[model samples]
Target chain A: MAQPLPPLSRRRLLRGLLAAAAVTALPSPGGLARAAEPLTRELPGTGEALPRVGLGSWITFNVGDDPVLREECTAVMAAFFAAGGRLIDSSPMYGSSQATIGHALERLEAVDRVYAADKVWTSSPAEGPAQIEASRQAWGVPRFDLLQVHNLLGWEGHLETLQAMKAAGEVRHLGITTSHGRRHEEVERIMRRVPLDCVQLTYNIVDREAESRLLPLARERGIGVIANRPFQRKRLIRRLAGKPLPPWAAEINTTTWAQFILKFIISHPAITCAIPATTRVDHVRENLAAAREPLPDDAMRRRMADHVRGL
Target chain B: MGGGAWWSYRPEDLLMFSPRVYARLFELHNQALWPAQLLALALGGMALVVLLRPGPRGTRLVAMLLAVAWAFVAWAFLWQRYAPIHWGIAYVIPLFGLQALLLVALGSLGGGLRLPGHWSVRRGLALGLFAYALALHPLTALATGRGLSGAEVIGLTPDPLAMATLGLAAAAEPARRAWLLLLIPVLWCLLSWLTLDTLGDRRAWLPLLAVIVALAARLWPRAPSPG
Candidate 1:
């Protein structure tokens, strides 16, 4: 049986209340020292200080009308926002993800904070604007923060619409996105010719193909780069599971492999943010923690890449 | 259209179709052909009734109904709809067509549907499975928190048809002949499981489990048929 302790003094009670408030005020920690101000990267064109970590809604948020799954996703989004995440990326190709996002955002009362990013992925040029409109309605947003041409699908036709939308203030920025290193040549051609504001492509420690050409070109063109598949869609993290983090991971202030890999991607000078999709609240906490501390320097980045490659 | 711009490709890009898109495809397919879905459901009910009352005429009717169901699902869902997003499904269309033809031949030539020699635990399990495929498969949406719009009905969708076929075949006797009927449904179960698993649908394992249970019931040693 437990025994009761001494009665609380007024001063001790006051101290306890103050400590409790402080603890409650601080963000939940999965890693890093404490809740530091989230690191931000400027959108090269607009100088908008977007958080270096964003959420992606690919397979993770496509729960379709599952109320339980939607509530779980809402909790995940709540954790993301509570940890200072901003950008939320989605594609119409991701099925019900946009609707799910809208639902979660409505419940969390987080619509205002969302830097909504979506894509147009249809083949018909005539259908491009309509697709964007449908996405807007699905998201329940009046305007999109970013609208990208998904995988360069009918990019030529869609670009014209995106440019008009940007000019008309319906979209804050316009860009193009591709993954799996597909069509880098085509993507490069579009970037060089079109006056675009951003480019998104897959860039993880293993899939370093983008570092060679796309990242450099985006840097050269002053185009903001959003890194997709930072964990190779969980392949990298799953591969590194149970493997110990390098002793030097402390230099980057990361405690988990998810943070280690996410830090590696966003550490690159060219990358503005890395949108890592996650369904779990704990993972969201871990991912958002990567943005709170100083990212690795170039040499550190190379060393981190080598460590994962060696693993 | 440009000299340097050829189509870009990636193996993972093939997996871009989300579970939402997969479910929405079924919803659209059902909605686009409304009354026909009712007719298909009616035919499935008839097949189950005929299968329970085993006779040569009833056997022929069940086979004919299954053949038509497979043919309709293949032409309507696989060839016409699923092929657009997944070009690889085009190759599967022929397999479905072949299954339909095989059923037609089996109905005309093979001995009438052989009911299990006697009631047993395996036979009871097979009946329960068949009833689940026919009745509960459509209510999966309710379980998954989806509306009726997303339901996949027996005889209307390939997964349920494959499931029901395995369940019915498990309940039938003459194990050697039942093996022939088992082939296509087993293949379909494996294929659908892989596709659904890729889409991150939890229901992916259902078909695979059905295959395993049916095979287990089939292999369960039966008491020697009474002379």
Candidate 2:
């Protein structure tokens, strides 16, 4: 007779279930292949590990009510989860994106696995709560896993509301986001004064303004840094289309230009995760592949930057 | 769709206006150009009356009104504003102007605008299409989630003008001459369908359906001319 099997721990059981789900979520043949065991980073405030690669819904997920396009978006989301992605960031400013995400979630049945991050984007203090409520409804989520003040719009008023919501368990974490390096001083001032769990801003190989101040400050303040525009909205990738990746990219296990650029962002010690939005499944697969082992070291990070700048 | 460096950007990114931004533009256009819209509505009303009771002078006037409307939209919307964001609009402006000039030339040489000699299923369908352009196209915004403020009215916006032109062409006599008039509007419909599809707007199929109905009316066997 076979020896009696040992009882599985709850953590191990959950992992097994997740592994099975990931396998089931794999794309059919002729679709992009899935990545395994995605890399993750710990949130400094809560010490919870989050996948280093996440999806942003700025323009990619704004498909409004077209069944064919929605199906394509569903495929993109399915591929995202299959690669162990969890965080999906959106905002009211990205019109219809939240609604589209809700539609995709309904179709994919992956709501429980999603780490929903949204933003309060209105300028009115009174309107902030209503906007947040609208975003929640659009996303079909009972509560947001992370809520941020988009571009620091009405930051003072919205930050207080986000904090209160977090305390009340309506939001898991409170944060603020900015992009294009706009209002960095004000963002830094807020970061210094407020006890934010996360601060999102644009940081790519070409745009490294965050490295001098925001990244260092986030590190000192124990705030998680979420990097946005990892590909600079496809500008960097487009600029380097004909150029071949340097042999050094192999050290970080990067193949495509997208991977090279994303690895550069996430390799930074300050960045907890980098959210890159794409409408194509192949692109999503390529993006998530950047989250695998052998991220660039400090010297390699510098080399990555220099390589792009030279190109 | 993929070729060269141009394919590097997604089709949606090429759109200068988001749906909200596009709606806001219509709002601002309507607000700033107030009573002008009322005047355009009056022209559309006149055109409908002429369409019902065909006459040479009334037909010429309707064609002139369409030409003026297309020219106005080309200047006011495409050339001045939309071109700033979408560089392709500069090329599109010329096409609108060309369509307007075609209408002007056709209106000046006046036999093609006469309605079909007899009433039939084909004629009724054509009339319905024209009526849809005038009476129903504006209301489509409601179903499309764009609201009444963003509605593209006939004799005011490019879409309804293109749509109404096809409807008018389908109802007119001499299939071969009408086919010449159908060319620009059909092209516009296809272009609009592609752009709207890229934006994921539900109304993307509207132009396509209009094209199909227009083609059916054009090809439908005409009731034998009255003896």
DockQ of 2: 0.05
Q: Model 2 residue B100 lDDT?
A: 88
lDDT for model 1 comes to: 0.80
TM-score of each: 0.68, 0.60
lDDT of model 1, residue A153 = 87
Model 1 over residues A6-97: C-alpha lDDT tens digits?
79987456445433432343365764335645789998979788989999988788766656667667777777776788999999888678
Which parts of model 1 have CA positions greater than 4 angstroms off? A1-36, B1-49, B52-158, B163-190, B196-227
Give residue A163's lDDT in candidate 1 (0 to 100): 92
Clashes of 2: 0
DockQ of all models, two decimals each? 0.10, 0.05
After superposition of all CA atoms, the RMSD between model 1 and the true structure is 10.9
What is the C-alpha lDDT profile of model 2 across A82-141, one tens digit per residue? 888999999887756788889878666778989999999888978999989988998888
The per-residue C-alpha lDDT of model 1 at residue B83 equals 66
